[model samples]
Target: MPLAVYILGLGIFTQGTSEFMLSGLLPNIAHDLGVSIPDAGLLISAFAIGMVFGAPLLAVATLSWPRRTALVTLQAVFIAAHVAGALAPGYGLLFATRVISALAYAGFWGVAVATAVALVPANAKGKAVAIVASGLTLATIVGVPAGTVLSQFAGWRAAFWAVAALTLLSLICSVLAISAGHGATEEPRTIRAELRAMARPQLWLSYALTAFTFGAVIVTFSYMASLLTDVTNLSEGWVPGLLALFGVGGLLGMSIGGKAAETYPIRTLVLGTGVLVAASVLLAVLAENTAVTIVLVFVLGFAGYITNPILQARVFGIAPGAPTLVGATNTSAFNVGNTLAPALGGIAISAGFGYASIAWVGAALGTVALFGALWAGHLQYRTLRTSSVVAKGTAQEEDRATTHA
Candidate 1:
């Protein structure tokens, strides 16, 4: 809503591109360095792993700092990592740099979400967070594709250099923006307290939903290039473009999800997730036709992204005490899905399953996730119903006693 948010979105865009650009550059990187493609692929995994670990860890560690300071510091770390990645001599150094960058990316987003929420009024918190998260999807539409092309045309090193420049700019904005009042201190939360908050069944279920959805998407997305070339009979040149198409859908879905979250989150999750399931089915069925595949892939991206904000907001509702921890852990859940999905997806493909089979697998996973979301809605309803009944009974008992007196 604010211009500051647009600046904040820049940081997110930079991080998102830094995180995913490698998918497009893997071949160039491996060939230049004389490494295997699968080995180079691990760099992407490393960044994700950093996000998974860095999210919760930094969220806890930075509890004492001003939100702005935390974000700036992490962005600095990301910038330094990118510089290192650009200058990295061998695969080992590059992989290590990704881990370092991940720490920053994870920490930056963790603080970014908290800062975004605090900046807004109570009524607008849902919308504010969605807008911030949308930066990640927006990166797909622009950042990653641009970086991919830059990596090829200018060399992979140039791509990292570009991301570094963006991160440095984010650091500048992080310093200039953010009001003192908004940066007011937060209550410290220890790991034990964080764990206690997560012990709630509803809280865990939300995380489970995050994990499942991420897994479903990542499994298909990791090998989406292969699918494009092998199943759809497209050129390697189309990989980044198709990926960007998915991001376009994600951007649209997230925008729609933000509005939907405002009116009725529960219904949104159930129905939005159902869309993802159906789109996955369409993608699987249409993978054979180039024209049809192009349309289905974008639809899948749109459907999958629309569900992100709802799942995120649900976690906050269930575990309000550890807000940062909850959000960070949910971020972790997304990466966990990323990690498991590709490995499993690859296994499915290797076992003689067609490339399209991965989409079917994702579709099946989406079906399960859709049902899980519905179950979460039911659980939420029952909890509220019980609380209302208890409150009403207490009021009646007090009324009767007052009359007797």
Candidate 2:
């Protein structure tokens, strides 16, 4: 992989930490801003909403810009937003800053993914994506926890300041490392051309698969703490450690899937989603058994993440002509899942289905994703067969004309 790819990953690490660290700091934020915990939690939703809208829009707006320029500009915006957030005296301002930060983060992610794949060979695209995505998994293991600890010792504002400083470093590294001409589109694509590429059915299928696959795990993961405490009978202290364990599993999954997805995209998706469905079912059935639940949690993380690189890489394959827009829409699709699954899980809990039901919800989503993968494979097969037939017909016609000559 290119050095620029790793540098982009570093940028993603800082932004991802900011994205998730708010969860740990919500209580502190709520108390400081004189708001309810639920209200503070809306900050997270605000970020998601920003990501959902910002990615596609910013991607198109910057479609013709140099990749390095777009990335650096977005990082600068992100750093400024975080600084504003850290200094904001009231909740409304902080919320506005979160939205701004997320918009920057989402735009950065779309451009970064496009740039990473552009820097690598077609065969290595999945691995490149995995390398970039590893930053987020690492953030789950290291950054979020460290931010929580910092918030505990100093204050929540300190965490925001730290993220801003780190992001500033990333922005500097990005400026120094990435080449100006690398990953610039050979020809600037019109917005109409990009939108035209998105009209493919296979591309939409890929988007749906991406959503369901990620949503399957998030549905359970969003409420993992409650399940671990109220159902598994573990103390709160164990939650962080177990969450770290899940992150470890995700990292491992990324490593394995990255190497396999370029060669076996459909197979990787099938196997990964299948395991995810099984793990969700097992977690639901055996939630009362602490050991079983713990084991399945790791399995759930591993299974869910193993398909991530494939999902990211496959869209580029399906819509090679419109990588920027495809990348942005894929990012939006991911947030769609992120936003919906938890809400659905909350409804289930409100309906008295219990926390375990979220696992069942995950299982259902995974099943849909699993079937979608198979369907995608079928579509690829048919397309290949049709192309083969057309090629053979053209060869026969050429042979006939040569014989007559």
Candidate 3:
């Protein structure tokens, strides 16, 4: 793998920290902004909405731009958005900044995945993506917890300021590290061609898998702090450490998934989603047991992230026509899940089901994803079989013509 790939990861780390840190800071943000906790949680949904709308559009808009240039430009915008967020006067401005920052974040994610794939060997695409995605996991590990601590002491705004500074460092790293033409297309793709590529059913299935699998994770994770403090009887200080544990599990899961996906992409998806469903159900059942809850958090994180490399690689593998656009839409799909999961979780909380019910939501989504993965695999097999039959018929016709001649 190239140094450039890890640099993309560093960019993801900075951006991802901003993404997940909100989960931990929701209480502070809600109190300070005079909004209810659910309203603060809506900030997460707002960010997801931006990504859903921004990713594919941005990818198409920047279709002709060099990958490295797009990445650095997006990171710079993200940094600026965070600066605004840190200085935001009230909830409304801060909410607006979240959406703006997410647009840049989504654009960066799409380009970074494309660039990371372009930088590596054909056989190593999964590993390359995992390496880049590790930045997000590491953000969970280092950035989120650190932000939570900062938010705990100084203020939530302090965490945003730190994120802005770290993002600036990432932007500088990207400018210096990524080669000018690292992932540029020789000929720019037209809008029609990109749209045509996105019309494939198999590609859509991959998107569904991304949505459900990731949504399952967010359903529980979006309100994990409340669960820990309210149900598990853990002090607020323990949330960051436990969140770090989840990150550690994610790191391990991605490593395993990345390696396994090289030869067993569909199988990896099946296994990961299966584990997610089971873990989520079990977490729901045992939500009150502090020790079991802690263990399940790690399990849930591992299962949630393990499918990432596989699904991402699957999208690129299946959509050879417009790799960048497909990757962007895939990012959108994940955010769609992100957006819906939290909103649904909030509904569950408001409906008197309590925080533990979020795990059941996760379980349901993961089950849907598992079926989606199985269907995708079936479709892939049928496509391969049809191609083989057509090839054989073509060969026979050629032979008959040669004999006649």
Candidate 4:
């Protein structure tokens, strides 16, 4: 892929690190700000809500801007927000900063995905997306752990400061790397045109599939620490290592799925979602077996992430005329799942289903996603068959006209 693609990935890495590192630092933040842990956890929901709204809104607002300019501007905003977060003296200020940072991050993500797809051939779109998304996987592997370690040694504020510094670097690199004219769409689309594209039923289906598939994984993952400690009876210290293992599985899944999606998008989705459902079921059934639970966690990551590129690529395919908006909406769809899964998992726990119940929730979501994928495949087949019939009739008409001539 283009160097700009990798640079965008690097940018994503910084933002993703900031987004996820809060999970590890919540306890420290709660204590420092004189809040309850649950209150501090709301910071995560604040970010997710920001992402859900910010993506589509910013995509339209910046629809006419140059890709590089938009990306750099968003990164600058992100850096400033992180700095504010690092320096904030109270919980309210920190929460506001998190919302602002997430807005910037979400906008950056939408633009980056569109830019990455614009930089590649149609056949290579999945791989390009995978390359960009690899940054998030890498963030889970390297950045989140580093932030946790930094928070442990230097305080939580230090982690925010580090993220701000890294974002500044990414902003500078983006300025130098992305060409001024390399916007995702050749011509800027009007908001009206993008809105019209959303009329397609298939596009909506794609978004639903994206949400369910991702939600399935996140339901279990959101409560993984509790499951490990309470159900599997592991030490809290093992949490980071296990999370890293999941990240490793995610990276591998992305690599495999990216290559396969270009040729077999439906099959890739089906297999990935199917495996995810199976893994969740297995995890739920075997939670008490420490080794089995550990192995299933890796499988969960792998199965969950393998469908990501396909989910991303299919939206672009379905809505070729509205790349930016489609990208933004897809980003929103992801956060929708991120936002909902935790609530559902919490409800299940509150209902006395326990930590393992989250896995059952995941399995249920994955099964829905799996059926959605199969339905999409059927629709694709019908569309192709109709197109083929039309083409054949046109060819026959042309042949008859030629004979008359």
Off by over 4 Å in 4: 184-186
Clash count of each predicted structure: 0, 0, 0, 0
Off by over 4 Å in 1: 187-195
TM-score per candidate, chains pooled: 0.95, 0.97, 0.93, 0.98
A best-first ranking of the candidates according to their TM-score comes to: 4, 2, 1, 3
Residues 362-383 of candidate 2 have per-residue lDDT tens digits of: 9999999999999999999999
Instruction: Please give the distance, in angstroms, between residue 299's alpha carbon in candidate 4 and its true position after superposition.
Output: 1.0
lDDT of 2 at 314: 91
Q: Write the per-residue lDDT of candidate 3 for residues 242-290, one digit (tens) a residue.
A: 8888889999999998998789888889989999999999888898999
Give the worst 10-residue stretch by lDDT in candidate 1.
181-190
Superposed by TM-score, candidate 2 places the C-alpha of residue 309 at a distance from the truth, in angstroms, of 0.8
Query: Candidate 2 at residue 255, lDDT?
Result: 90
lDDT of 4 by residue, 57-151 (tens): 88988889888888999999999999899999999999999999989999999999999999889999999999888899999999999999999
lDDT computed for candidate 2: 0.92
lDDT (0-100) at residue 350 of candidate 2? 94
Global Cα RMSD, each model: 1.8, 1.3, 2.1, 1.2
